[model samples]
Target: MRKRNVFYSLFFFLHLLQQASSDVHSISGYFLGSQGLNLPDYMERITVDDVGMYYYDSTMNAEVPCPEWLNTTEGQEHWKDINLISLDNRHRFASSLQSAILQFNLTGSSSNVNVYQGVGRCSLYPDGTLKAVLTHAFNGEDFLSFDIDTKTFIASVPQAVIYKRQREENPVFLEHLTFFYKKTCFERLKILLQHAPAVNMKKVPEVRLFKRTKAGSKVLTCHVTGFYPRDVQVEWVGAGLQSVEEEMVDVLPNGDGTYQTRRSVIRPEENPEEHKYSCVVHHSSVAGNVTKTWEEHSGLAAWIWISLICFFLAIAGTGLLFRRLCKTKDVGI
Candidate 1:
């Protein structure tokens, strides 16, 4: 059963790789909320063509100067009001918000395009009160909570109002953002993806297997290098032919634009010889999956084997030489 599961996993991984390779465009965006001692809870930046198009600095309570292409008169005017609102409510609450997020994302393919936008705000007050709100623009969902029994509004309304007004005024803000991003960003990305110089390209992976001793235990590692697209799946199959737990390190970039990743599994010490391991790598560049089996030949073992072989050969040669000399002596006598 475990063997069957391993094969099924390999098959699914290969199918995923094929589908990923056929994809032409890739797009991703992130909205992160962090707590800082000296910084604001909310911040955002948008990039296009590898250039920053728009930035909002919550600490400064202002929108930084954008790229010329995005600095249209209308955009400037719109942000002016938004910035004013941000500044007005910058210090209204006694306690700062723990975290807040406002993010938008767009991804496109030949057949479909996906867009997502969301906002979330959470604040803790000095009077042991908490307030939070989360909104998803794509599905028109809003979640809010507060722990206060007073008439005073503990949270700011300007940011929420501005977002709501923007959505109302421009029903397709996500679509427009996607369109603008494609016009300014996707073109360059496409060119980079298609025309990556041959000198900077790697078509096949170089795989290596080795063992390391750490904390008196043996660790087996599969090192894969010189692969393109930066998305590769690696698995370790133990003696039972089941996928073993492995720790995969982050993928690091090579000087020539290829990528490298490492996966490792801890080898059990007891009956280590009875346990065999194999590393399987799946990449789009390779037609089929690559598998490498582990060998138990340690450096010391290899040296001992070579030394024994040489010693036996030396003894046999010496005996033959002595016999030849004795034959010569007998003939002379």
Candidate 2:
């Protein structure tokens, strides 16, 4: 039920992981805010495939769509309606925050503001099926949730039980949620996807393997960049077909039309060659998994550097001999 920063981060990470492991598209809406003017009074955001569709906050007081997210006529109308809805919700948000404060006895002066947030999201599977979830949080902790599949409310904390029971008793809000997520949300996303420019395509990501040594510690980093559709996997595979993973950051857009991400793993200090670790990537755009092997010590690269140095020295010697032949003794130092 709780979702603001940590919730969104973890949820989106799992969302992208699912995208890589399966075939599905999702749309999500977020409403987050504090109780008063000490912070953002009310904020709303929507996203598709991890790309922001629009942003709304007390500062902006408008649902400002990202550059191309509202280009289509239908999208413009949809935002206009959504903006009105958000405006009404912004007013309701104050009361909701106050209720949360009262629920937890968190009331205080204007300087000591409390926070509340909620989210609703739906994911469309490859077979055209959709699932929706709703969650609410207070002071950065989950309290209540709704499962669209079960059509029931769940209380994550004792304070949330009353609200859950109220929602379960009242059929109106539940019915509205069903319609909005199943019909309105899906239709809007489908329209937007259909209207995207023809140039948008699933692009194979460019992958690179590199290492960084710091404080006598070395680590191998797999950099995967410039990919499309927000679905890609980067992992470190070690000996005996074991998949070793550290903290792989979330996929982020490159401001172009593609996305980039990185994964890093510790480089073994002892007998590193015994592992033969490799960075492996998987994406729909790629025919198969892309594997890049890494080594702690690269003799081939050292030999290549040595060969280049020798070639350059030989060229310098030839130049020096030519200068002597031309009787030019004063070679510039």
Candidate 3:
């Protein structure tokens, strides 16, 4: 029984290893110098590093040859124009769509020789990602390589999920949701906006502070007036150029070539006097940059001082009127 159990375990492990190896594919190639010094090959894998990968072949180190044909003065000038020293001797082939041959032109040399040749094919993943691969024959040996530019599709493969309800045709829904009746259009609008991409509120409709509260908090709003897709963000800062807490409310656009947005932050609570606040806007149309801050000032203390001066003047005038009435009565007596 022990021997049978060990055999079954080994079989399961081998199956898993086979699946992993089958899932992997790679593209690689090496460069060789004129004197036959071979450099490192460029290599990339599909299962590892899902994002597209690239590398420059640089393994050759043999000295460049001064050919006998280019020994004259005119030949020397021609050699200067051709950067033969830094030239890539190997033809680099890129994979592509459809069954076809991969080709690259040899640079710097006048021979116009086709460096590398291969048969290639490309395919697209279900999630809109693309991959291309190629194979070539050299010196009676077969070589294979694959393109690593299908990152977006590879990353989109969904993670496996488990569901409690198995059957697709029969779904469990609350058997008629009852005791709910209200005429709220805004609720439906909110639901639609939830699935919509978040706006980069920091940008758009020129950030401006249009109003202030009695206690000394500035009201800021922005308009994203460009013809680009709507993506924006907003924030507030204090006089010291630091981020401050704020309460925000969403104001919808009127669909008349305008969008409305506003937010407010408590400023006077921190100073109660002459202090400043800034409105910052961020948006994607502006390359996801933030505003430098639209400024606002608080003058609550100044308004208090003006009210006190007016009250004192009214009291002095009342006392003067009483004195004048007494003087008039004494003169009549």
Candidate 4:
């Protein structure tokens, strides 16, 4: 099933932003609450520069930090305050999930699940300028957003009218939210960056090429995997090639806490010797761009077959996780 999967989309978006500006730093927190699934009832996670920094669950009922994340902050008030906030957010997740289901009129059927994602994030750039965003989405599409520049709520979809109007009436609440996103979140991001060590620094990408024939049409893919700091750029180009139409799959996760992404393009009519095509990648992890050309050897068909099978299996293992990238907020009455 091809779920919209806001979690994947948001991560992809963050990756794009990071890839765009190598010097930009950001911190994001995600809270998920659900029922009738093969997962925990509620969970919270924090990411610093696309790496997991902290995690919490209702069952464990405690915030666990990555050793690298706390290596410089042990026995300090910073960790203590963040820990308390995580505990308090456990209760908020329950109410927010319930409110979301009711607000969206989710049927809660066995076969259907919709992701209602709300994001509150702040990014600090090399120029000492910061950008803040506060928005919510339903099924990877925008529903509502708070414009930091205007300090007003925007209902992007019809379903979000209720929340937009309700929040608009409460100017005090909006003021406090603006303060959190603009000031507090950035402060948190700077503190975490200051304490974070070189252990979790940028991860260089591993790239490969795979050729597959489906329905008598040839497709070439550049598979890049096992990378950190999720910003990456992939393009198809070679001698005498202007541009080749390619499709980029979502930035999927690896169990070892790294990430992978792929770009595939249908082969155009051309001779391998005369019209060679290569995949070029650009990212901060690498000093410069990395390029890999496709090789079509006589005995390569058998190897490509095996690679195609593994590709499908990998997608099967990675479930279509349709969820949100929301910031920690007081969702209380």
Candidate 5:
């Protein structure tokens, strides 16, 4: 599965490269959500720049072209003065049909908000002046006509064609770093947890297990969060503090400044009296071992009950034997 995903990503990037120099109007594609819904609402504009910037609502991310140097102090100050004064009117310039389509997507209405999770694409018109024919999956099965002047849809196309635009200069290493630093990591993480609480950072495993209540068998799930490097391991320990063997799953990176991992298994759902279990997180940097125990209720309770029962049994047996010996002695006399 890992290899397959890598292959698909490479293929998609190559396909985007080939589509760069063609002269066709419009392309159409679809996105399938987690539930396989062809949700148009989550569909934002498809951008084809090497920068691959997406515009969801009316406001465009004007910082796309800002170099990573602006990630520092002086660069930001310079950009504030230059960008606002000089380029305020046109951060998005449309010299071709593709550029026009891009600008239109960026200039959406207030009510337009969508979060897409699948695949989508568009074809552009090849005319040097301004002509793009493309298809959008969420809108309909038909290709939509893209206008260069107004940056809106005018008509639909019957077939997919090659739409080409002039290639801009490739971004330098600093540009790529800035792109990820600004676009992918932070912004995407915020989008993923759009429904979550403001303080809830989305990708941490945050594994959690409920209190064990029964006696025969029990399974607990714990949440883990903020794990980096994408590789992590989880283990369960018994009352004797011995490790138990169980199946494990591969951890996947969220790419948005967070990682997610999970561990689940069946064990003695320790009784309220003598239950004990521990969840340990294993990683290289952790000194010795990193573990959190949930014995506040189970392990301590069991130990206390066992100790009390043993004490009473010992006392009663000793008293009964002594009484029997005394009675025998008196009878003999």
Candidate 6:
């Protein structure tokens, strides 16, 4: 019985392992190098499964050859040491390489210093699970991870490497490394800010109110366009109060490289005028939340105004005809 129980436990453990492995479909590593205001920056990306390697010149937006060392026998042997057979292992090696490149580009004693950045990413299929680790030479030895599922960021290194590195007792060397890491981190942040999307709040979203004829309900839609940096918040405010539930659509890309999103609210059997409905938008580009109120105009109300105007015109026309006939009769007599 004990042996049977152990067998069952082992099977369950293996099943969990298989499940975890199936969750991740592909892994990739990326590196980018840039000098201040320099054209033809260097970029390289490698994926484990599809598109094994890529090298490009950023300024010209053209493909380029891999580094000379990578083509050598020693380089090939070093690549084999990274064990690129397994996707997960490939990403690990790629991350280490990224870190090495970043350090070399950013920390080296060169007259024309350049910034290097590297990223290791694992992507899961169907479930849209993404795990990404980013390393910058400026940060010293630390790396940051982002989990798409939880929307959280974590900063750290592998436990085994941390233990090994901590055992080294050279104070001066350690201090120098620390200083270089801090400097690298600063430069990386500066480069990121320089490339960040610019904010423009000149064009506000348009809000429209539409009534459903059969359901006797009103729908308020907020249409926002011509926005950058994809991350935008849209909300619905009802009668000066917060809406309990609001439905929002995903942000879509435009032809011009901008982004747009929409939010909508449905109020049933309620007079649109009696209860105010406002669409509020929040974006990094804007100083504050932009709010637009809904103006109600029903088809029945429009037709009623048109009929009243036509009736008044018809009455005036009949009065003029009667006065003209009276003058004619007087002249004939």
RMSD of each: 18.7, 8.2, 30.1, 12.9, 18.3, 20.8
- Sort the predicted structures by lDDT, highest score first: 2, 4, 1, 6, 5, 3
lDDT of 5 at 322: 54
Which of the predicted structures, 1 or 5, would earn the higher TM-score when compared with the native? 1
The candidate maximizing lDDT is: 2
Candidate 5 local lDDT, residue 240? 40
| Candidate-wise lDDT, in order | 0.46, 0.68, 0.32, 0.65, 0.38, 0.44
Candidate 2, 1-333: lDDT as tens digits: 332554454344223332342366667778876754345678787666655565677777445553564577777787777777678667767766776677777667766646677787778888888877778877667878887767788888887776677667768867877788778888877765665452246878888877666558666778898887777778888754322244648887676657889887767677775567788899878889888887655634655665666566667886765444445333221
lDDT for predicted candidate 6 compared with the true structure: 0.44
Which consecutive 10 residues in model 6 have the weakest lDDT in total?
13-22
How close to the true structure is residue 289 of candidate 5, measured as C-alpha lDDT? 52
Each prediction's TM-score against the native?
0.39, 0.68, 0.24, 0.68, 0.32, 0.35
lDDT by residue (tens digit), candidate 5, 54-103 = 22322344543444423545444533533342232132211222332343
Angstrom error at residue 89, model 3: 65
Q: Can you give the lDDT of residue 248 in candidate 4?
A: 44
Q: Per-residue CA lDDT of candidate 1, range 1-333, in tens?
A: 533443453332222221132223332222222232233444443321112223454556335543343344654454454354344333322112221223222223322211122332333233534333333322121212222232112223433443444333553644543343334234433333343234234468888987776667787889999887666888888864322254547666564546678888878777776666889999888888889888565544766665665566667786675555434422200
Candidate 3: tens digits of C-alpha lDDT, residues 1-333: 533443443332222111111122222222221211131322111111111111224443543343453455644443342223134223222221001111211134432212222223233333544444434422112333322332111111111011111111222211110100011112222222232232111224565454444335444433324322333456666654322344445433334323455665544444434454556666544655545444333333445455565566566776765555434422210
- Give candidate 3's TM-score: 0.24
Superposed Cα deviation of residue 174, candidate 2 (Å): 4.4
lDDT of 3 at 288: 54
Clashes within 3 Å, all models in order: 0, 1, 18, 1, 42, 2
